[model samples]
Target: MPIYGSASVAESGPQATVRVPATSANLGPGFDSLGLALDLYDEVTAEATSGTAVTVEVEGEGEGTVPTDERHLVAATMIRTFAHLDLAPPGLKLKCRNRIPHARGLGSSSAAIVAGIMLADALAGAGLTRTEKLALADAIEGHPDNVAPCLLGGFTIAYSTEDGAKAVRLDPSPRIHPWVYIPQVKGLTSVARAALPERVPHADAVFNLSRSALLVAAVSRQPSRLFEATEDRLHQSYRAEGMPESTRLLHDLRTAGIAAAISGAGPTVLALAVDDAELPEAPEGFEARRLDFGSGAEQVATSRRE
Candidate 1:
């Protein structure tokens, strides 16, 4: 376990507003490692109050569907983060405005987790470094791919180390444009993971290894190679049966020479294209839109007691 050591404690009634971006993980062959932050976002405002109750107000995305109590993902993460800092706030109030679609491989959960950690850190004046925050977020989310881009933004390559999760951020090529296709039905990451095979052939492993490396170069500098760099043999095909529409769309886009892949444990498909490339229309039951690469999570506002 990583310990959070705070040099200073904030006064009571500290409040902070944080905005975290949605992330797309496994951008092709880099399963559990590659991620890109999207312009879609979830914003949270947190205030430390005077009692033990936790209250949450939500708008958009999961407004009525998600829990509004401590059981909520952001609230729960905040509570845990406060505990780690050895600071006990009497109570907490959170207001969440979400735009990222849940369980559609757009990283709604990662955004929530990052939002909570950032809010707690800002309010408590914990002064945790970005590395520390990444470790904490990765622990909560169980992987660094989504959390990495949600925290650091841009294009990221995340990996685990003995110390914790670490990542490198790279600016994506300006010429590469991204478009997402979101489905009306939701996806469950757990179900998708269960659909994967325990062992793949050695040749398949080698195939993904080469493309994953190529994907890094393609995204960073060689936009022309994206179509080839995004090819994979590790996860998508294995999970395709569960998401026919997404899989079919991915296939259609790729066949037309677009770089397309499943986003995270997706029912959503992410298509990458360079300048002036025309993408096909979204299939029925899906909504499509172009998105810019996102910047990292930011603390939009904070109120500190005198």
Candidate 2:
């Protein structure tokens, strides 16, 4: 069965509960293309109700801060998805349990968008094909890297086509282990992106291209080549000023022979290890944790009105 299948509906109104994993994009050289799903997750339960009113409740990561009405990201995306499918919007009550940290280069926004799309499809039994769902999500998120892994799981390479955004997933080698260093300070993707140069040297472009290809091989089969494969001449150095601490941490880890890179836009760092590698002490404001590769977004449960 597909990962995000329709929910089981009975005599009562339809409801769905979905779990989406956190994702890290641009794993070094494959900027705006590569992504990996992490074991961390955010779960959302959405129920269709009688009236047009929309209500939302959030716990864990984004508790009191995010919007509680239709303006919430998940609710808003659901409304958009219904319109995309040419279906009337339904009254909704959403309960979000978020674990992925917001603005921490951990694909939190992509997770919310995917959750909304999945919930709408399940509740309405829209029967959207996987490609249709991916296109819709990539359109909304403005990129496929994070959303691809959040939806398809494992390792993903996202690219745009004439139709829309598309991706392919690959299982990472068993020897590859992931460790994340999350800083207390959150980063704005906008700020990090703004730091990049509009153009890079042709030689630099060649540098990243070769490593990007090698990165696929290293992540898929040759875990030993990860250190070399993860090297990049694009993006990271340009973004260093905005995330000095993350840059420093990445350097330290790589210096110690671990394959380290700034996760997404940064302030967080991801280290790919092939053994029981000893990690350095977390910086003053960072927390270090090990995470396994995640599967895909899943419809975990369903509810019916009694």
Candidate 3:
């Protein structure tokens, strides 16, 4: 069965809903190293209404700031999905209630991309596997770290290629606890990416490879090694000039005995907050919750959180 599909589709019920989770990428040593998917969501519901025009209503951070026309990322991606699947255009009544902070290295765009692909699978009955949809979402977004987590849910590591990416599924270990701190400012992925040098010296390049390889091994085996596993020489620290607040937070996290790093090209810092607690014990605005993959069949609508 297509991973994003529902068992039943009611023509006259509530509009189909999609909720994608927030993500923090590049967890320090893990530069494009690693990304942790969070429970915060960006939700999108599309229902058939008495309609001629495809009406879109948006709330939360983006609000009226985003385009409502075909230019909007949501509308545009959905339209693209329909064309790809060769389905007749189903008029969209898109209502978005977003909790994932925008431009905060939490995969807002990835969420948008996955949301469209998921909707196409459900509405038009396109038979798409989670991996298939992930590939499409990654292709549209130019990366997989964000899109993979949204489609599959939970902590994710993706290996991307010209064709697409292949991802490994790991059970959320009970010994691992993720603490996410989102500051009160927006962080742009473009700025994070552009901050990287066009080419690195061979020695520095080897440093990244060594850390990335060890990080992958740690993620697969010793949850204990994550403290040493997820470090990077590639990007996060260099982008610090643009995101000083996060840089300060990183220092604070390390001082507090927490293993913290930039989350997904970050402006958000995700750390291992508690030992032996699968979820965080702290309150919101100080610490964010951790999400685990219940059984691997995760469905996200609109809202793409990878």
Task: Please state every model's RMSD to the true fold in angstroms.
Answer: 3.0, 3.6, 5.8
Task: lDDT for model 1, please.
Answer: 0.91
The predicted structure with the larger TM-score, 2 or 3, is: 2
TM-score of each: 0.95, 0.95, 0.82
- lDDT string for model 3 (1-306, tens) is 222222232233334577787776666665552566667777777764333356778899799788876666776787778777765455567887888777777788888887777766666666788778877887788877777777776667777876687566555556666667777677778878898888777887788777766766665566667666666677776888998877887776666666678778777777764455343333333445454432222454323221
Q: Each candidate: what lDDT?
A: 0.91, 0.90, 0.67
| Number of backbone-clashing residue pairs for each candidate, in the order shown | 1, 0, 16
lDDT per residue for candidate 1 within 1-306, as digits (tens), equals 222222132234678999999999999899999999999988899887765788999999998999999999999999888887886644778999999999999999999999999998887777989999999999999999999999999999999999999999999999988899999999999999999999999999999999999999999999988988999999999999999989989988998999999999999999997998999889899999899999999999998565
**Largest TM-score belongs to which candidate?**
1
lDDT tens digits, residue span 90-191, model 2: 778899999999999999999999999999888878878778888999999988999999999999999999999999999999888999999999999899
Superposition error at 5 for model 2 (Å): 22
Q: Which candidate is the best by lDDT?
A: 1
Candidate 1: give the clashing pairs: 51-90
Cα-based lDDT at residue 8, candidate 2: 27
